[model samples]
Target: MSYSHLLLALSVVFVWGTNFVVIRWGLDGLPPFLFATLRFAFSALPWLLFIRRPAVPWQKLAAFGMLLGVGQFALLFLAMRADISPGLASLVIQVQVFFTIGLSLLTLGERVRGYQLAGLALAVAGLAVIATHLDATLTVKGLALVLAAAFFWACANMVVKTVGRVDMLGFMVWTSLFAVPPLFALSWWLEGPQAMASGVMHASVGVWACVLWQAIGNTLFGYGVWNWLLARHPAATITPMALLVPVFGMGASALSLGEPLPLWKLAAGALVLCGLVVIVVWPRLRTALLRTNA
Candidate 1:
């Protein structure tokens, strides 16, 4: 990878890592759906003003938004609100990686490599440990919701790979546009107009700050740079950089929220990180150092 690409990847990891803390902080004052709604609303402002609508068909755009924006965040926020540890939540959502790969095979005809299969096996085992170790009397419903969010994320990934021929930033912008109304509608319907009204009126400035960071810092800058890098580099170079996000998420959550690092969670993190190193970094390093340098 070029130095510039490496730097961009690092920026994404940093922003994404810090986002977990922002979510936790934002949740303190804002209801989950309300927070998600306002987040996209804030994120959409710049896109509406500057970026043109994406060239993709309307159905594709709407589907992408439904999966990535409404489906993913709705469940994620609820899971967080249900007291799934932020760090653990970061770790768990990674199940999407495997799901994405699996779905890509079925839908996009992308082949899943042997090593990827191994990584999936390890991830599943790790999830078992995490789920088994959850606090007694904790229902799997919240965990199931988060996993469902991951499935939506996987579907969105496939959408981007298949349908996102337009500029990456533009795709995000339009999808967010398509997504915002449905999200707000869902919030209004389920959480009630009065609760949302009360939430807006009573939300703290700190909560707003959290929303801003999530929208601008994480969503815009983070995804913007990420899409840029994806356009510039090979998937081999770009995709693995995302693995670092969960590390940052877990660590930041633990530190910011005073969440514990159970022995199993730490072990699972090590396994996942090690697998990422093997899948992403090791191959690029070998190719660059041996083939190119030689």
Candidate 2:
């Protein structure tokens, strides 16, 4: 990638990474489901007015929207609200890569490579380490919720793969539209109308900014630039930049939220990040080794 493009990729990941912190900020004023509802609502409206919907079936759009907006983000917001710190949330959610692999194996009959298995094992170990160390910042409920969110994210990935290539931005916008009603219903049912009303009424300007950031900065701009880069470059070239997300997530959490980076947390991060590295890098390495042997 050229220097400018690399910087662009970095900016996207930075937005994505810091998004956990933004979610934390938003949750301070709004209930989780309500926060999610507003985020998707803004993400879809006005833009969806002008942008044409992708050619995919409405069913597909609805499914992806629920999985992403409700299953993934709603749960994620809930977890962040009470259970997990933003830093760890950012790190732990990445287990979705492994979940995606596992789902593909079962659903699509895709073969798993040794490196993928190795990566899974390493990531599992890291998660186990986290499980053993739950405290004020990291709770059992938080970890479980985030893991569930990761599974939902993997499911969303399957939806995308099934849909094949379409206008990703349009797909996201339309799917986001489908996500809003259900999320509002969920907020009403679970968080209670009183809570939602109170949150909205009492929300600060900063909280609203966080909500807008989630819609425009994190969802639209982040994915917009990312897809643009993928269109211009190979997936292998573009995708690996995602590894920086957790690094930035943890760093931002520490810097912004004063989240502590204890030694154990560092070790766990190393293990998980190393596993991700192996998963992303091993295929390229294997191909290069085969050519060398030839």
Candidate 3:
């Protein structure tokens, strides 16, 4: 990655990692679904005027909107509201790699590499460690919801790839626009009028800031650079940057929220990082060695 692209990727990790804390703060007054609705609503506003339709078709765009913008964020927001530890939530959501891999195989007939398989194993083992600490109440439903969120995100990834060609920023803006109504409906049906009213009345500036950060910083700026990098470089070169998410997520949680770093979670994180490094970098290293010998 170029220095600028790397910076944008890091910015994404930072914003997304800290987003757990922001969501937690937002939940203080807002009901979960309502907060989500307000979040996307605010996010879609600036882009409503400026963003053009993506080159992708409406069918694919709508599906992408439902899966990614609505399903993923909605389930994730609920999981956070259910009090899943932010650090752990960050860690667990990385399971989207596993889901993405599975979807690619099923949809695109891509083969899962041996290194990816090994990385998946290490990641799963680490997730087991994290799950062992969950309270009984937090165990079944909340975790399931988060996992569902990951699946939705993975499905959205498939949609994006399937669409083949579009401006990623345009896609994001349009999908978010498609996301608003359903989310508002969900809020109304699930959270009701009174809670929404109270939340709107009491919503803090920080909450609005978080919404903006997620919309502009994370979605537009972050994915803009990422899509550009993917366009310019091979997946082999760029995909490894994702391994940084867990690291930044855990670090940000610790630094911002004073969340304790457990030894097991730390160990699992290290393993995941190591596994991803081996998967992403080892092939390049082997090629370099072969060239040197030749």
- Give the alpha carbon lDDT tens digit for every residue of 68-179 in model 3: 6678988988888875767777777777766776767687776766765676566567667766766543556677888899888778777766766568777777777778
Top TM-score hit: 3
Q: Candidate order by TM-score, highest to lowest?
A: 3, 1, 2
122-162 per-residue lDDT for model 1 (tens digits) = 54565566667777323477678878998887787666676
Candidate 1, residue 146: Cα displacement in angstroms equals 0.2
User: Pairs clashing in candidate 2?
Assistant: none
Ranked by lDDT from best down, the candidates are 2, 1, 3
Q: Quote the RMSD, in angstroms, for model 3.
A: 2.7
Worst 10 residues of 3 by lDDT: 231-240
Model 2 C-alpha lDDT per residue in residues 1-294, reported as the tens digit of each score: 566887898799889898888998999899999999999999999899899998999999999899999999999998999889998888778777667767776776767667767876776676667557766888889989999998897788777667666787898889899899999999999999999999999999999999999999987788667655655654334544565566678878888899886788678767767766676667778888999999
Compute the lDDT for candidate 2: 0.81
| TM-score for each candidate, following the candidate numbering | 0.86, 0.83, 0.88
Best by lDDT: 2
